[model samples]
Target: MSINLSSFTPYDLRAKLGEQLNEEVAQAIGYAYAKVTKAKSVCVGGDIRLSSESLKNALAIGLSQAGCRVIDLGLTGTEEMYFATVHYKLDGGIQVTASHNPKNYNGMKFVAKNATPIGRENGLEEIRVLAENILNNYQTSLTNQNLGPIEKHSCLEHYIKHLFTFIDLTKLRPMRLLMNAGNGAAGHVIDAIEQHFQNHDIPIDLIKINNHPDGNFPKGVPNPLLHDCREETSHAVIDHQCDLGIAWDGDFDRCFFFDSKGLFIEGYFIVGLLAEAFLSHDPKQTILHDPRLTWNTIDLVKEAGGKAFPSKTGHAFIKNDMRQRDAVYGGEMSAHHYFRDFFYCDSGMVPWLLVIELLSTKQQNLHNLLKGRIALFPNPGEINFIIEEKEKAIAEVENFFRDQDEKAINIEYFDGLNVEFKNWRFNLRCSNTEALVRLNIETRADPQLLEDKLTLLKCLLNKWIKK
Candidate 1:
């Protein structure tokens, strides 16, 4: 009997361990990626999951069976595969990771040349169909000649060097930093970066918490967005008196930060901070931001003499938009920071480095630097609710506010439903990765108005969810 992979999405194939995802399914997906991308040489990597290695092995075997040379970057994060693909000039790449999902779940992230993402509108659907076709038509027609060779390579040094390019080592302040790896794939990379800094006498003291690469995830999955997941990092920053705190998700693709006072800064504000940082160095640079939270980023960019463009959410959309606009920087409130210098792909490591440089050059504490901005743009961050009828919920929210006693309210559907009033606005959209409907709201220095609207929206969201 042929295997079925119903868990495959446009961006990746994810499933619980030994369930929908197994050796056969992973192999088939690899074969599909090789066939669809016409990749002769490919790079494969995986996180510190127990089942990840087996999946990686299956993927390598499938690539080999398709007569393609596979470069194995053992126990690597998602971005490493991206870096390997473009740096080695390979045809494509795959990284095995569920990315902050439960421990038993594992998945794969795919990309074409130059680390370009293969999403739904791009090549992911094609890859999914081909993978399913291969699975449903499975047979024992395999032979030795069909299998190629799997070579092992390490690009850690190159990746570390690339990260160094984002900041001036000499200008980097000798400050203690609290780093929480969440026992995912970020520890090794963090170690590498720290080593280089130490060797160069950079005097950047890195206080790492949960730094070991443990698939067991004793401290729970490494999603810093979760209020609970950030405690350790935040406490460490406070106890150690660190200048800054950094945390990453399971695959280290998304990075989150806490100020010197151990206050977790929302990623929404980081987008504006980064925009200002880049614009400070070179004015009038184009910055691409997601439409979810626009006013702060737009205002910051414009004030710095930079152009701000809003793109739909998601890495593929952001990267494509960045390329089209030749944007120097792109950021999502979800902690995904993309750089034009880094092949327009998001990087968790780069964001922190850039932020450090901003602090050092400006001679301001992390908290002080962002204090005014946070006060100016108070956001409650993203609130997600599980609603089966996502479309209806969105429409109801839109209709409820559309008839309000207000004029000049703007509405945009760049990614989802964004209803804008002059003093406050909210964006309601179904999550691409989950069944939840996410709502992000911001106000023009009006805390009470923001809270009032948020409470009103929550009530509406609960009403719709119950229905």
Candidate 2:
């Protein structure tokens, strides 16, 4: 009997079929072979998950089956995969990762030559269809001709050297720094960085936490956005009297920062600061920013003689926009930073490096430098609401505040519902990857008003969810 695989959503497929494909390494190999049949080479990398190795094997088998040469970059992050794709000038690449999802889950991210992402508009949908067909058939050809050769390559040292080329460590000022890798794939790279500094005789105090790579995530999930997740890094910074603290997600492709005072630096402020930094070198350079938090970013970009372009939130959209505009830098409130020098790819490593350069060059403490800008947009951070009926809740919220003083408010529906009052604004967006809804509110300068609005929104959400 032929099953209707098309009926299953990506998440559903993950839940139902993720475990059945024990030999998925072969499937990935086959898919790569089938897609890049005419290509000269393909590069591969994976996140720090226990299942990743098995999946990589299955993928290698499938690639070999297609008769294409493969360069296996063992145990690396997504950005590293992109770097290998560009560095080798390979035909394409793939990274085995679910990206910040729980441990058991695993998936793949595909990229083309020059590290261009493959999305629905480009090639992801087609790839997904092909993968689905292979899953449905349940039969992979195990012929010798289908098997391709695998070559192991290590790029850790080369990647670190390449990263340093963009920012000169020699010019850096002495400061105490805290780094937390959350036991993902960032340890080796961080270690390499420390070695580089030590070897060069650079003067800086470094504090490390959970820097070892472990798939079990003994401390907690690698995500640093959650309040609970920031505890370890925050405590480390305070204990060490570090100038700054940085934490990365599971893949280490995105990094979050805290100042010396142990206060979480909002990603919005980083976006502006980085935009300003880039514009200093190239005036009026195009900068891409997500729409969630734009007022402050726009002001800073314009003040720095740079142009700010707003794009939908997501790596695919940001990358596409960055390429089209040749944006020098792009940032999202979620802490993802994209650099043009990094093949227009997002990297958790690059953000901290840039911040370090800025701190050293300006001879300013992290908090004092970012304090004024962060104060402009006092945000409640992001709050998630679990609702049975998402659409209904969204509509009710929209109707409740639509006409209640139009003169003092502005409303927009780009990605979700955004209501702007004279001094405060709030965004209500449904999670693209989950069933819950997220609300982010910020005031022009009032903390009390922000709290009140957040409370009212929660009450309305509770009312809608109960109904």
Candidate 3:
């Protein structure tokens, strides 16, 4: 009945369903979350994963046992939980979703009041301790907890309306776009948006594929960031003559974009594009970005009369940093974009709506909007290596660069080892959830330097991964 507490990573709880995650574990986590946060009102939801409903029901039972009024959101994406928590002014919310993980895996993402994350750094550890105690020894500090009522409510209409607020609907252009849901939780959202566009007389055409919620993941996990997973979206863009292409993962918290030419635009460049879009609308404000790839974002943010700050790379760090700096926007190269107005939470639906509005206002395609920025700041894309001693490998590479480059201008240690020179720079960091070291190299208008630096890093990290 007790599950492995090791499943609680620094960010969220995720692992193989049965061995590391189960109904008992979910209930304990829910009970512990209610106790630790003292959240009297909470919302619970889950994705289309086969196990998610059961896990969510157990979790809600625990919350109800703790006397917390539970709003059950049935089947929804991760962002819906976030929005529900903030929109309804609940004390906490939990979503049973594994995001882009394989079908065999499932997990939970938590948010407190205002949609702030609950993680190891904050209250996840306490939750883990309490949950483990309750699950294994049947112990509790407080006795005779009051049971509260559980209500089934759907916040879909309100959530869909909230998404349109990010862009002006009147300015939306008449263009064809491809939407690939990969048979995840995103299909219903796309369908709803399309129906809204039709009713409102918005002239955009929507082409949908894999637009059904299926636990089977017939198309394989819905992660368009992978090279092979992108084929369907890209080919569909051309086949449908779409002006742009869009795709989402299992939970649809993050979205990927493809240009009209069926070329996959790097999330790095898209970050810059989104920053530009926000600053253009607001004139001036702070923007947060990850150090994995920075030059383009910095250039665009500065040019758009905004200050760009680098934050530690994960969602927890980015959200905290965005609040600290009061940033209007924050983006990571991994396709996560957080908004200031949206309770500082990331949404897959928001970024695309803004982009389409941008295209309509600017009277250009996605490629034209990106080509110049892409050329100005060229990167070979992120290269990842599976290394055993990743920390040691990072230290060695950092020392090598420190010793070699006497003129390294801006060496940042916020999230990773980023050494910046005048023309070229690179960031090498260990992934928190994997045995991999991610390397990112970017050059300022120098393709040759980018290639050379990439080759050098590939050769250097080659030995570390070989073992």
Best by lDDT: 3
TM-score order of candidates, top first:
3, 1, 2
The lDDT for every candidate, in the order shown, is 0.88, 0.79, 0.90
For model 3, the local distance difference test gives 0.90
| Per-residue lDDT of model 1, residues 1-467, tens digit only | 65566677756667887747888888877877787788899999999988899999999998888888999999898888889999999988999999988888999888888998888777788877777777676443333476778999999999999888888888988789999999999999999999998899998899998899999989998899999998888889999999999999999999999999999999998999999999998997999999888899999999999999999887888999999999999999999999999999999899999888888888998899989988888889999999888988898888877777775378767689988888898889997667799999989999999989899999989986754
- Total residue pair clashes for candidate 3: 0
Q: List, residue by residue over 328-356, the lDDT tens digit for candidate 3.
A: 99999999999998988999999999999
lDDT of 3 at 307: 96
TM-score of each: 0.97, 0.93, 0.97
Candidate 2 C-alpha lDDT tens digits along 1-467:
54333321322122222443345533643463356335557787877888777777777767766776888999998889989989888887878776677766766777778988766676655555565556565563335564557899987877898899878888788988899999999988988889988999988767888888888889876998889899888888999999999999988888999999898888888998899889988887999998787778888888888899888787888998899999989999999999999999999898898899999999998899988877777886788888767878989988889746654457778778878888888888887656788888888878888888888889999876644
TM-score of 2: 0.93
Per-model root-mean-square deviation over C-alphas? 1.6, 2.7, 1.6
Candidate that beats the other on TM-score, 2 or 3, i.e. the better one: 3
